[model samples]
Target: MKIAMVCLLSCCAAALCISRFAIPEAAAKGSHSHSLGYRCPMHPAVLQDGEGTCPICGMKLVPVTASGPASDGSLAVTPDQQKTLGIAVARVERAASSRMLRLPGRVTPDETRVYRINAGVEGSFRDVAAVTTGSHVRKDQVLGSYYAPAAVNTIQLFLLNTAGYDRAAKKKSEGSLDGENVDLISSNLQQRLIQFENLGVSKRQRNEMQRTRRIPDTIEVVSPVDGFVLARNASPGFKFERGMELFRIADLRRVWVTADVFPQDAPYVRAGMPALVVAPEESSTLSGRVAEALPQFDSQSRTLKLRIEVDNPGFVLRPDMFVDVQLSAELPEALTVPTDAIADTGLRRTVFVETAPGLFAPRNVETGFRNGDRVAIVRGLSQGERIATSGVFFLDSETRMKAPASGATASLTSSPDPTGRRTSGGGAGPFQKSSGDMQAEEAAAHTSAAALR
Candidate 1:
């Protein structure tokens, strides 16, 4: 009887030990399962109260928290997860936004100051000038002389008409000729003078030819402007057709620098805006004003062209030379944030605002001008709010995954689209079920199991 009592006491102690450890383990497992729900990893929309195969993709479901979505349509992200994802954050503030554009430039001569010298009549150069290309010449300076049969014929006609006019005048003075005859002779003479002018004979040369009563063999070509010769095609004894180009002259007192500005930067660049041209070879920076903003962009580079007029006092800027250009603009002070902080979906632009520690909610915002690294916020946010800048795509993905949870408001709802139109966000997704229905289903299943037992 004593041994039986000892065995019974040992049995009671073992049962107490099993209850102490095994019961709590079972309870802990039940608590964990109750707090979590299951969904197909392949399809986050297929959420269920318990683990099961996905109806659509036929993939095994994974466990997710039943309370994943917060009341304010925010998603909770732990600090450890943020660190692992390399997420970075920044604050919104108010300041004057500015942008600086740097672009490659090329020097070009101003069209208004450039002149092309061409042969006035059919001729061969009798004598070429001593000056060559790059030589500076003064206005009215004789560049070369050319012999043309038209010029000789024109001068002869003028001399003949002058002689006829003189004879008619003398007869009128002697009362041998009528006034009508004298007037007719004078009109013919004026016609001959105009012909001489058309044949490249200057006023002084025409007058000399008439006074001397001689026809010159060659006509002198003179420069119309004081400038440097850009091109010289004159050669002695070389036959040339009328209106053929002989020389190109350009005044380099002012020049144009064509710079390529990107399309995004084109809006701020306008005529009369100040620009700076950097000549690395000359070791100087020249100030200029935007002469024109070209309407079209280059097909290959996709950049807009800007014409800048700069005064070249020492003729430092030359055609076809490359240089650097700087353009800048300042926008009015306003609320701004880093450009990367905003996530643009095709329909609307969103920003994740840090509502609480480790919690972020999406806010729809309207953006103004985008300056280099930052953008202006026109509406929907206040200054001094912190936002995720670096890991916005990851946050967006997390939000999308929790969007189908019933009674869990998703931040992607009821916001103004880019066009300032309000959109409704009151409807539930097709695959979503309310938490109450899921709870009722689980209670019914438990009752069925208890009755079977």
Candidate 2:
């Protein structure tokens, strides 16, 4: 019995000696703890004491600085780690934005500038000009001339009446005029003038006849507008009635471009909005403005018809010419971020907002219209906050892996020694819960207490 007691005392003394001296030396000489070390949030096996990126998945190592309490699931990356991960950040900005709507359409002539030439009097074409479709014409330029007998007789009557009036005026000047005869001559002269004017003779032509005392073989007609010939019906010898159309001319200096706008984009298309037209034939772009939109919407196409009036200064745009149109509209000031920063995970849209220095939190944001490379944040984000613009995938992957693991064991208890050192006596730090316990908690939350006193 005494030998047994001695042996037990010897074993107790040896354990005390090792605990006081040898265990501490072994701990100091061996590998280090993870209290200040960093590891890959994706693969905890990839660990380092300083900033680094994981070789397996190329994810940045996150410092497990958990000597304190558990995290709220926000990822804290140091400046060195951010640089190693190639994370770039930008601040959310508030400014006026503009949206450009690109549409395809075609150009045609302005309807108001279109002119149709018609025959003024029944006559045969005698002197047609050297012209055809697409010929350029100027105002008051003669396109063709016709010879009619009535036009000749009409000129003769005017000349004879003017000669008679000259004789009657001479008699009055010599103090020998008959007053009744003078009124008769004046009435006849006015009637002859109307007949000549009705035959398409101008007053200037009449004055020329009176000066030269001779009439031309044919009366000429002129174009009323400076334009290009769109259609020509009359040939060198074609006969036509009084109201027959000879040519259709249109001023090509200005044109109208029409496009069909989708219903989603129709609200921004208002009258007077400026537009730019680009065509393959033109070396330069044409400037235009929205003239009007037709009242009738195309139900089958689900589109609204839009028209824009553009100035074809060089006559580069032509009827039936295809073109591309760009229309711009102003947008109200709103918080905006880079469009590439948003991550769509099928169920939610999220961005990495830097809640603190080198710390990013996954923010669920509602998005609005996208203007170029920027997107408007309709909700869940505020102005002046910085967010990750590049390297978002890494941040997303790291946060997702760490958040669930930390939450899985948050309810476990912890113990501390006399020296205030945490001892591994529980499942995990106070930031987790097992799956079954979590399920029970959620179920109890949905149940109701019917008999409350």
Candidate 3:
């Protein structure tokens, strides 16, 4: 009888102590913090004007009081996690911000400088011993020769005219070809010589043909620009028509650095923007300006074309050579933070703001000018706030995994999906099935054996 009585008295005493002291202290804490109502200390999302237990974890309500401005989605990190995740923080401040853009590009021939060498006249190719693909050619150097009927006729006519002119001049001591002192034969001879020169017959060659009185059948097609032979189409004895492409020449003294830019960044790129291009194998850097942004984009690469005109003084940059390009721009004054702080998704940008010691919360933000490691904050943040700069990605992922889902209401109803599939735990979980269902599906065949038996 005495043991039962003692046990009952002890239990009553313990209950009274908890109710009068511990509960009041917790209530006072909640009241002092919020100054209006009570809230759960562990889950601040649960708020009430009166004291109550947390709905998520059933923890006792603590008093909510003024703790300063902070994001509601703030989460606390333990010391171990901070070390493991390499979390780093910096204070947000106003400073001069500049934007430096880095782009990967390649050295390409300037469209205007890539000269397509075509046969000047129609004839068969001759003495093409030195002409070959990848040949370095000088200005006015013959690549190869080709035979064309009209070209042969012009050269032969030029030789005949010049030879006839010389003989006429010899006879012109007696007067003109028409036997007049006015000498209209000189004018006619000059016209014939100009026509022959229009056929790309050099003065020296014409002179040689005239002196030898030879009716040249084949003429040499020469390069107008000093460059490397990009392509060769002519071969000895091959009959090619006039205006046919015989060689493709490109001057490497200057080239174009075509940078591939994403469409989102296309607005800042414009003509005359200063740029620098550096090749991986080359020692010196080439400076240039944005010539133009090609209207068409590469279908497979889906990148906007930005052309930079670069001077290759020593022939250091070659066509198709990969290069790194940097473009810098200035921006208006604005609040900024480290670029590493921003968490980027395709549709939205977020940052982890340090609310309290070891507590970081995600805040949706708009970003502006980006320069190196710094990014301008257009919205959702203020100066004098602290933000997690490095390791924000890991912190964001950890917060989603560890923090309780806010505004989660309990629902037992099996929500139907678009396909009429029953989705438990309401329709807002994810766009996909839970892991439990996936596991059960994977194990369903093993359970079927019991039904068969």
Judging by TM-score against the true structure, name the best candidate.
1
For candidate 3, the C-alpha RMSD (Å) to the true structure equals 13.3
Please report, as a residue range, the 10-residue window in candidate 1 with the lowest summed lDDT: 420-429
Local distance difference test, each candidate: 0.71, 0.68, 0.65
Candidate 2 residues 364-402, lDDT tens each? Answer: 999987788888899998888899998676666655545
TM-score of each: 0.62, 0.54, 0.60
Which residue ranges in model 1 land beyond 4 Å of their true spot? 1-31, 35-63, 71-73, 76-96, 130-135, 157-197, 202-214, 292-302, 332-334, 343-350, 356-359, 364-368, 378-453
Q: In terms of TM-score, which candidate is stronger, 1 or 3? A: 1
Total clashing pairs in model 3: 19
lDDT, residue 144, candidate 2:
77
**Model 3 lDDT vs. the true structure?**
0.65
* Candidate 1: tens digits of C-alpha lDDT, residues 1-453: 645533433433322222222222344365435434555433555555455644433334445544445665575566766675556877888988667778899998899999987777888999988879889998878888888986766677778889999999999999999999999989999898777656666676677777888877788877778888999999899899988898899998899898988887776777898989999999999999998545467989898778999999888888888999998876779998887788898788889999888778988999988777888899988989988887776666555555544353232133222332211232223434566654544444344334322
Model 2: worst 10 consecutive residues (lDDT sum): 444-453
